[model samples]
Target: MDAFSEFIRGITRDNPILGLVLGLCPALAVTTSVENAIGMSVATAFVLVCSNVFISTLRKQIPSAVRLPIFIIIIATFVSIIRMVMEAYVPSMHAALGIFIPLIVVNCIIIGRAEAYASKNNVFFSFVDALGIAAGFLLVLVLIGGIREILGTGQIVAFGYTLLSLPINPAVTTMIMPPGAFLTIGIIMAVVNYQRAKKRAKGG
Candidate 1:
């Protein structure tokens, strides 16, 4: 429950995507490029952090019978704000993300945290939890996007900048397709599971 442990858990043990396997819709859809992954992650983080804090602050006043609706309302408000800001400043990415942006209102990670953590914790702890989970979300999305972009296009491009290019010619185009997302996530999950199993065997 300490801040540091909670934060680290989000990135490692409790990762929203890799660990908990939540929020896969956008994780698979907008992760074709690192830039899009970053954009979506940041937007989700904003909404999550804002809603977490707001819900935590009013937990005492919210009725249990109506908490779910209240959580959605709070989450939707922040989602709208971030959507407008992105549309105004980063129109291309905004369009790239498309329906997934509005769909953040229903993202399980955010809604789950609001009910399971934010509603039961103090504002500070809720904020910490949100930050941890958001960081984890960002990390996994970026990893998936980087792998896809590099394999699919043989290069990494972000916001008009080419970060890295591989010597491979005619990249595996399929890597950028839907199946590629599934393959990349599946491999990563397998590797993670293997590592965890190894640790368990050694009594760690």
Candidate 2:
């Protein structure tokens, strides 16, 4: 039950994107389409979960003074693995995500989780936490990407299948640009914040 609670907490109560507001660079950069968003999410999830497990396993052995360097090395190793796998297989996604893929090594969400949760918890718990946080981040990425794609391009596709086609509007082109990404995420953050405030007021 404690682990389950931790899982839920990572997703909503402490979401890396919305609640903690970490990893915004990639969140905004690679979220132009659903496919790219999913790719980035999966890549980050792999790095986060694997790094957390390894960190948790070696928590005691890692000296406190050098923990940051150790964490970066571990994270870089996983990021390299992700980069290699994506380059060899999903070359399109690899190209679309571009530099952002390599930048995941420095993403605060990964490092923050390692320092805050993985460094203090058991391997199993850290894995659960990583999964939950990754899911939460993926959820936001998809939502943002879906909105941008549907409004900007008038279509939403998962893999090669079309999910929905919007009625075309000449004015909707803004959604495909940087300003739209900021606006979409800002509105979402506002809504989430409001709901949380309401829940707090009602003692939820």
Candidate 3:
């Protein structure tokens, strides 16, 4: 039950994206398309999960003062691994993601999880926590990306396969711009907050 609670907490009560609002940089930057958002979220999830497990294993030995530096090194190493692999096998995704891929090293979501939860929990729990947070982040990214892609471009494609294409306009066009992303996220956040308030009022 404790483990389940931790999992739920990571997704909702303490979401790294929405609730805690940790990694807004990458969240807002790479979500121009669903594919880019998914790639970035997956890359960050890999690093977060691995770093959390490692940090938890070494928690006892890490000196309090040196822990931050050590954690950064560990996170950076994993980010490098992702970068190399993406460049080698998935060059297009690598190119599309751009600097944001390497920037995962500094993503607050990964670092915050490592310090706050992973460093203190067991390896298995750390994995669960990382998964929950990653899912929550991915959820937000997909929502933002989907809205932008459909409204802006009139089409939604993943890895070259078209999922849905609107017939109303061949090009709404504005959805691909920076302002579209901001507008979509703002409205979504507002709706989510309203729903939460409604649930609370009903004693949920």
Highest lDDT against the true fold, candidate:
1
lDDT of all the models against the reference? 0.95, 0.93, 0.87
**lDDT score for residue 132 of model 3:** 87
Give me candidate 2's TM-score against the actual structure: 0.97
Q: Which model, 1 or 3, shows the larger lDDT?
A: 1
Model 1 CA RMSD to the hidden true structure, in angstroms? 0.9
In model 2, which regions exceed 4 Å deviation? none
Mark the regions of model 1 whose C-alpha exceeds 4 Å error after superposition.
none
With a 3 Å backbone cut-off (N, CA, C), the pairs that clash in candidate 2 are: none
Expressed as tens digits, the lDDT of each residue in 1-204 for candidate 3 is: 477887788778787877887888787777888999899889988998889888988989999999999999999999999999999999999999899999999899898999888888888899889988988888888878888888887888988999898875667676778878778778887888998999999995
Query: Of the candidates shown, which would achieve the greatest TM-score relative to the real structure?
Result: 1
How far residue 177's Cα lies from its native spot in candidate 2, in Å, is: 1.0
Model 3 / residue 43 / CA error / Å: 0.5
Kindly provide the TM-score of model 3 when superposed on the true structure, using C-alpha atoms: 0.95
TM-score of 1: 0.98
- Candidate 3 residue pairs that clash: none
- Models sorted by lDDT, best on top: 1, 2, 3
Model 3 lDDT, residue 147, Cα: 82
How well does model 3 score by local distance difference test?
0.87
Q: What are the models' TM-scores? A: 0.98, 0.97, 0.95
